[model samples]
Target: MAVTGISANRLELLQIANAVAQEKNIDREIVIEALEEAIQKGAKSRYGAHHDIRARIDPKTGELALTRHVTIVEDDWMPEDELEEFNDSAMVRLTDASKRDPEAVVGKEYVEDLPPFEFGRVQTQMARQVITGKVREAERANQYEEFKDRVGEIVNGTVKRVEYGNTIVDLGRGEGIMRRDQSIPREVFNIGDRIRTYIYDVRPEAKGPQIMLSRAHPGFMAKLFAQEVPEVYDGVIEIRAAARDAGSRAKMAVLSNDSSIDPVGACVGMRGSRVQAVVAELQGEKIDIIQWNPDEPTFIVNALAPAEVSKVVLDEEADRVEVVVPDEQLSLAIGRRGQNVRLASQLTGWQIDIITESQDSERRQREFSERTTLFQEALDVDEVIAQLLVTEGFATVEDLAFVDNYEVAEIEGFDEDTAEELQARARDFLERQAAILDAKRVELGVEDGVMAVPGVTGAIAVALGEGGVKTVEDLADLATDEIRGGYEMKNGERVKVPGVLESFNLAQEDAELLILQARVAAGWIDASELPQPPEPEYEEEGELAEGEYDPEAVFEDVAPEAAADDAEVAEGDLEPTRDA
Candidate 1:
């Protein structure tokens, strides 16, 4: 009867471990380990705190084993902390252990079986805390492992609770949090409500793994479309980009791999059934589905739908575009509070400046007048000749001076002699201007070494000198932003801080190159440390020469043709042939 009672008690222990492992969704081995640790702690209390007690449980059978061990060490062995005395109960010097066993060596442990004992109230409490703590640690580890690789995935969860404005969601295997900013505006969830969210991030924290969930993330909308649209899920149509004004409006750019299918039409679905489902999930947020184009300007045009764009001028260096629309379409192009343009900018990854046709015309005329006046004064040409040169795309005296003489001679009503006279005047003017700038640079106390740096022109040297960057060392110390201009917030308003070379309109890359060159000239960095430009890729064999391949020129030639094709398609006369 006593044997039967002992067998039942051991079976009950196994049953408890199994149940806890199953309930916590942790490994059975981890649970068993926790139990062993708890039993070991209780044994130490039962015997003596100075004893080195350990416990093990047979996973295959309901059996517990407790033991006390003393490890043999060298005679010079000391405690882990040099300041502390050695623990004789847990560790024995080899000389002492050899007296008991002649063959005893360092790391050899003498073990003794420990008799099972009932736990006192204090011991019971300590064991319970130990078990709870170990089990919780195991649960956290399991949770982190389960969800760490699940970022960028959409998840459905029950609303567990709300604290402040944040919602705690009970995912089946883990808990996720949707902070107030992550939740869609005006969206609310009650406890026990089922909600869908995107797992944007998962972080392992001291307390537990934090699964950060969001409904406002653009990825959430893209994933929803992937769920509602079979083509999106099957990869027949790919969502290239998405942007959201959350609960108000959103835009998605999609491309179809198969030419027969229109990406926008497929996403819109049959009578908007598919998009309607997504809209319902998002609490009636309006979605704009547009076809993606490899041509960035064309894509930007598509992104800014429901309004017409007359022209788009892109500055690739700045990732900025100037968009011109009809005067009557300005309001529609910009949308309420600039939301349309803002979403378009986000979708197309460009800074967009929308202007009316009249505004663009006025600005163009002002620029033309300024350039004509510049040519007339710099090259000493008459108004008609200057205007003609400006019309022929000669904006600077340097362009007129260094261009192939044939290009200028080929201009209407211009001969070789006239072109030669213009080139000669342009060169003489540039030389005089350089002399003036050099004199100004000297007057401003700029070092000649600053001018000697690569990429530093005489005008730039004078400009830097005026800005107090007179020496190569001073220029080297300047940041890219100090040369390229940037914006800063002042009293809650963003204000543009003009750079030293702001008038030169230097690109960020160019500014960085200039500073690096200055650093090299100042002996601050080696010339070899400068970043090398990537080698231009060429078509195979005889298609094109390596040095002749200019991507910007290629894109420029293709953009107008692409834009024309887009117009023909809008007119229902042509079909797009570009690949997905």
Candidate 2:
């Protein structure tokens, strides 16, 4: 066959392979393989099977070269005999081929040069197919390599196509998918529009690398901050936490290594330029930049910024924070639909309950108030009396009912017979009060029915009762001064009783018991049982001299005289003493 014009060259093929490798960013070997396949297909179409043909091009010159296969056979019935005879001289006889292969069989193969095959349209068409397919494969590989390392980074691209609500972005080198779920809601895009997104994921697919982009992920905010904040990029500010309700709001907590630099201000930039840029990218989603705080209370306060926090109480064991805010700021602190507090909780990994200042104050007042208000609809006088008795340090009405007549007489304005008669009434009151208090306790589900009485001194107990130290538990809740004042009572025109403080010479344990009794009486304790007070010691006195009158006689003359008419005092006629 005669050689055709513009013959393909090996050197040109090498140069084309190098250029393709560089242009496509693929291995040279890939281009080389494509070249070889193209050449083989072209050669097959150019030359018929009559000649065993192979093609080669000169590496230095633009020249095509070809080779043909010739067979050496000893007999006419050889494999070469089956081919259409080109010419009898084309086949080499066994005798002449013996020098090359002494053991040559009936059928033998050898290579010889043939004239370069002519370039034809059929061969060119075949080569084009091979080259196109190979180049496409190389381009896909190059695209994959270009984007694999870029996953989780932000990128800008033009909208190439939209299908099924997804946007296919043209990233110059490859296509990236912005799925419907990842796209901002209510956003519309047309071809040729420029868009920015986070490279959320990259995966190798059967055809190419699948590049996925997102605008909805929480990390997108972090990435945006990294891009806009120099401190973040330089490692001076670190994003400690982030939370987002995509297309609506996002919160980011940042910490700074340099004390002089404020992490929040750094991220916010001058006049809020930096964060505004991120918000613009997110399609008007709001951004909150907060300073990260190790103290949970401080962190919560920062998280709920712009609205002031009056107080934050943390229940560490419960992982919850109770935040108090001014009544006027409560709605602002809680935000619209609780968005502010929700984001703050998410940012700080805590459950936050917001309470208004008025609510808090009312709750505290209810807790520490001295008077107990019985529900008017549920009123029972016996119940009231029972509680009053318990408040007076008697755990059970039995203690009150067992008081002797003399003891009752000491209570003020009762004669011996009247005291006895009142005792009988006291028994009935005790039974009724006990039943009512126990029922009320059960109704209220009070686990600790009542606090034990604090084992305080008699003087202290008397003072506590008169001073409104009503319950054993109440005594416990009182401050030291309150407890000390409770022990001193008025004596006629003067207040002069030894209180717990005056009994300091007692043993430490005894003194503590006295304070404990005050605490119990204050209703600070819940247990019914209490430690008993120590027995009083008795000291015998020596006999006085014959002329010395008893010391008791000195104050006897001052005692008030009994009513000459023996008039009975009314049960409810007790009046406030002048000394009191």
- Candidate that scores best on TM-score: 1
Which residue runs of candidate 2 sit more than 4 Å off their true CA positions? 1-29, 41-123, 294-338, 341-580
Superposed model 1: Cα runs more than 4 Å off: 1-8, 46-51, 78-85, 485-498, 537-580
TM-score per candidate, chains pooled: 0.86, 0.47
Q: lDDT at 436 for candidate 2? A: 67
lDDT of 2 by residue, 362-445 (tens): 765443222222211122223233233223333333454587657655544445655565456657765665576655544443
* Residue 434, model 2, lDDT: 58
lDDT of each candidate versus the true structure: 0.84, 0.66
Write candidate 1's Cα lDDT for 252-301 as tens digits. 99999999999999999999999999999888999999988887778888
Query: In candidate 1, residue 268 scores what lDDT?
Result: 92
lDDT of 1 at 117: 77
